[model samples]
Target chain A: MSETAKSSALRGAAKSARVHVMRSQLGRVRGLGAAHGGTHHWWAERLTGIALVPLSLWFIYAALHLSGEPRSYVVRWAGNPINAALLAALVLATFHHAQLGLQAVVDDYIHHKRTRLVVLLLIRGAAALLALIALFAVLKLAISG
Target chain B: MKDIRDALMVGRTSDGRLVHRPLSPHLQVYRPQITSVLSILHRATGIALSVGTLLLVWWLAAAATGDAAYAGVSAFMRSPIGVLLLLGWTASLWYHFCAGLRHLGWDAGFGLDLPQVHRSGRAVVIAAAVLTLLTWIVGLAVM
Candidate 1:
């Protein structure tokens, strides 16, 4: 084959490859499932991240104000309907976000298959239990106070 | 050193990359930048928050257990060191919260430009500091 023809053929092949890559990337961006679980996880993390901003700030304000207060005072404060409702929301969102973030860390670092699975489960369980306990305590205070 | 050796021996994968394996451009090779520090802080705060949740569990369990236990926990919380930890936790919470907001912004297709990235990072740091100070001031007043 002539050198000019050979170079032209190579150029054509490169162009086709570039086009293929562009199409695949567009498909992945559209979330046709080629990207697997990443898009969902990313979306969830962002949603939770947005939620936690105000909820966390409110929690900090609530906690700081309670500093140096007596137990009864805290209980009474928490018993207020608005505070109780916000506290529940804060705990739930915090725990959910925590679990998702920690899961990413665990999946990133933990190497042993069994250990990774166990650690992931443990993280999920711990977050869930903490949320439950916090919610229950808030409810108890709200009711009993 | 031992952990590094063990990791190499095990030949583990982290984030789809080989861990502790012979690779070009290790973390040490790159100079530390603000973004790098912020990224590390994000993970550090995450781990701290995980541990801090246990403290929450303790407080709730104490409340569930009854008045005396609750009082004991409350008393401890009022102590100097406890107060310091509480303050630290509060700061961590604020910093993490602000950084998380930055991450959300990035995820939502904002702040990807270099100038915006740096600006957002600075914003996160400033917001966290201001919020922490404001909360502390209010706390002192309430107390």
Candidate 2:
């Protein structure tokens, strides 16, 4: 065969290989069905990333001011509605983002399959628990004070 | 011959090599860049936030447990070392927050070019500093 013909054949082979890989990927997608589990976690992380830009700055200011205050004064400041709301938002966003990021780290670096799974679960569970407790405290203070 | 036990075991290949496939290379080969460093910092802040959450929980738990526990935490917060750590954590939070916004921009198909990436990276740093300083100023004013 001519060199041109051989080149054309090689191109055809490459095309076929690409198509095969695409089909295999499609098959995997079909098998997985409508179980898009990580989407909300990802969206929450991104949303927090955006929210944190302002919230984090506010948190820093709030923390610095609170640095020298007595327990009663600090509690009263946090009990204010605006401060309480912002603090609650910050805690929630921080925990959500931390969970997503830690999950990615566990997936990437942990070699022991079982341990990796456990760690991922623990990170997520801890994040949720912490957020809940913080929210409860914020609510209590916001309502009572 | 010395005996060695394989905790995760598969059979050897016919060529007498272990049948382990090489992992895709990680961040080793590429020279460190500002973007790369910022990316790592993003992860570090994430881990810090995880620990910070525990601190938040402690604070809340103290509040729940009553005045004595709350006073203990409040006293710690007043300590010089504790204040410094809080300041550092606050800075980390702001820095991470800015960098994360930059990352989100990149994810949305913006700022992918080399110049833009570096520019955004610099912006993240400068913005964080400006924010921290502003925060401290406001904090001192309130105090």
TM-score of 2: 0.71
Span of 10 residues, lowest total lDDT, candidate 1 chain B: B1-10
**Model 1's interface RMSD:** 2.1
What tens-digit string does per-residue lDDT give for candidate 1 at A1-145?
9999999999999999887764465565675542235667767767777887788768766766776666778778877899989878878887888888898888777778889889989999989988998889878878885
lDDT tens per residue, model 2, B8-27: 34457657987754344447
Give residue B35's error in model 2 in angstroms.
1.9
Off by over 4 Å in 2: A1-37, B1-28, B63-66, B137-143
TM-score evaluated only on chain B, model 1: 0.80
Q: For candidate 1, what is the recovered fraction of reference interface contacts?
A: 0.51
lDDT of 1 by residue, B1-143 (tens): 54444544546453576555554566898998878889999988887887887777678666656789888888877789878877888778888988887887776779889888888888888998998888878877877
